[model samples]
Target: MHSFTVQQINEVLQGELVGNTTHSITGVEEIRNAKKTDLTFIGNRKYAKFWADSNASVAIINDTIDLEPGENRAFVKVKNADLAMAKLLEAFQPETPVFETEIHPTAVIHETATIGKGVQIGAHCYVGKNVTLGDGVILYHNVSVFDDSTIGPQTVAWSGTVIRERSQIGAQCIFHNNVSIGADGFGYRPADDGRGLVKIPHIGNVVIGNGVEIGANSCVDRAKFNSTIIGDGCKIDNLVQIAHNCIMGRSCIMAGHSGLAGSVTLGDGVVIGGSASIKDHTTIESGATVGAGSGVMNNVKAGQTVLGYPAADSRDMLKQWVALRRLVK
Candidate 1:
């Protein structure tokens, strides 16, 4: 385990330290579970209440929280305890796996492919014809990049990730294991002759912007005509699905298991809670937030917060809920 003195931790967080500056902290843990040598954080009132009974020797606390350091313990007070803890965790992060070679011998690279300097291709990885991988790109074992795709500099794709033909990915992006990009969209219609359904061809591709991070098993389908776009700094959680022609603006966040139907539009900074589903062609403007498990069937105004199935404004939903409870009584 990595160890740091209370003084060192305070320096890393740029927080004001109180008491036991020389105390050693070996690891971080939740306030209720921390040991005497562990470091913890109190970010809100719920967590702050547990501090007095916690056994931790050091704690990162919000400046707004009223608490005094007890004997033999130390407190590092910062404007945002959660953010301070994240910084400290980065300092303590373990080393990541390193590739044994720049390009593994078992990897297959097409003669027409362009691989820039410092690129690393792991075992069983495949780079198809006319593919362009920028400098410092890393494709972990079993990753596959199909024909005509362009992945920008410093992008890292983990095992089992597939970037299909004509897909364009931007710089500093991270694709977790099993992520599927540029898959054919779900589009089908009944056959004219009264037979089985006919599949609609998805001829376009997926375009992802810089600094995006897609969690494991998430899928972003290719567009029916032009492109399915994900803007810069967007973070998509595990198991999420983004359908064809969806346009997501910068810094949008989708929690685990959330999804957007075909042609859905999300403006910058939109937040979709876990298990939320947006209907086809629906628009969610910038800064709008959809509550967990919501089934949005219409457009959501910018900065509005919606809740419930066929989601309505949060305030209206709450009032309806209250009325229903009274009716039951």
Candidate 2:
């Protein structure tokens, strides 16, 4: 961790500095775990009680927080403590390794592939025919980019991820370990002559927009016709499944274990909570939030909050929960 004097930190964060300006801060930590050399934050009002006794020499605090008399601690007051802390953390974060332009000897790159300047292909990876990788793209060990796929500049794909044929990923996207992009959709037809299911070929690809981050072990299926789209700035959490032809709008967030069935549509800024499931062909309007463990079977109006299995409005769900508790009593 990098050390910074409180005065220097003040210059960086542009916060109102209070108390010992010369104190050296070594690292960031939680309030309960902070040491004299560590910086902590009180972003919530409930956490203010811990601040008075905290060992932290420096803290990031909201502008409106109450500072009691006789408190000797130093703090940087900002409009939003959480955002300020995030900025500070970014400044102190270590630099990531950028491999040289040369592909590792163990990597298999087709002769027909187009690799841009400063691209890094790690060991045991495969870049198939006509694949186009943008400048400074990094494919870590065991990554595979199948034929005709295009990856935008500065995108990083971690180990064991697969970008299937014809997929298009936008700039600055991150694909975590074991992510499967553009896998065939789960589409099948009943076989004739009393046979088993017959596979339906997915003819389209997955298109991920700029600055998207797909978490580890998530799978995004190829579309039956057009693209299965993940819009700009969307964040998908670990173990999420985005099925065939699903479309997510810009800045939508899907929490861990959430699943979107085939052709589901999410408007901009929709938030799907952990383990939530959206049924096929459903459309969730902009700014809607689906509560944790919800099963959304139909359309949700803009800015609505839904909860429960076969989700209803949050107010109704709360009333029902209260009624159930009364019955038990």
Tens-digit lDDT track for model 1 on 1-329?
Answer: 79999988888888889888455788899999999989999889777778889999999988888888888999999999888898899988997788889999999999999999999999999999999999999999999999999999999999999999999999999999999999999999999997999999999999999999999999999999999999999999999999999999999999999999999999999999999999999999999999999999999999999999989999999999999999999
After superposition, candidate 2 runs with Cα above 4 Å error: 68-72, 98-101
The numbered model that scores best in lDDT is 1
Clashes of each: 0, 0
Stretches > 4 Å off in candidate 1: none
Candidate 2 has an lDDT of: 0.93
C-alpha local distance difference test of each model: 0.96, 0.93
Candidate 2 lDDT, 1-329, residue by residue in tens: 69999888889999998877445788999998999888999888899898777888888989898874135568788999999999999878988765654689999999999999989999999999999999989999899999999999999999999999999999999999999999999998889976899999999999999999999999999999999999999999999999999999999999999999999999999999999999999999999999999999989999999999999999999999999999999
Angstrom error of the Cα, residue 258, model 1: value is: 0.7
Report model 1's TM-score to 2 decimal places.
0.98
Could you estimate the TM-score for every candidate? 0.98, 0.96
Q: Which candidate is the best by TM-score?
A: 1
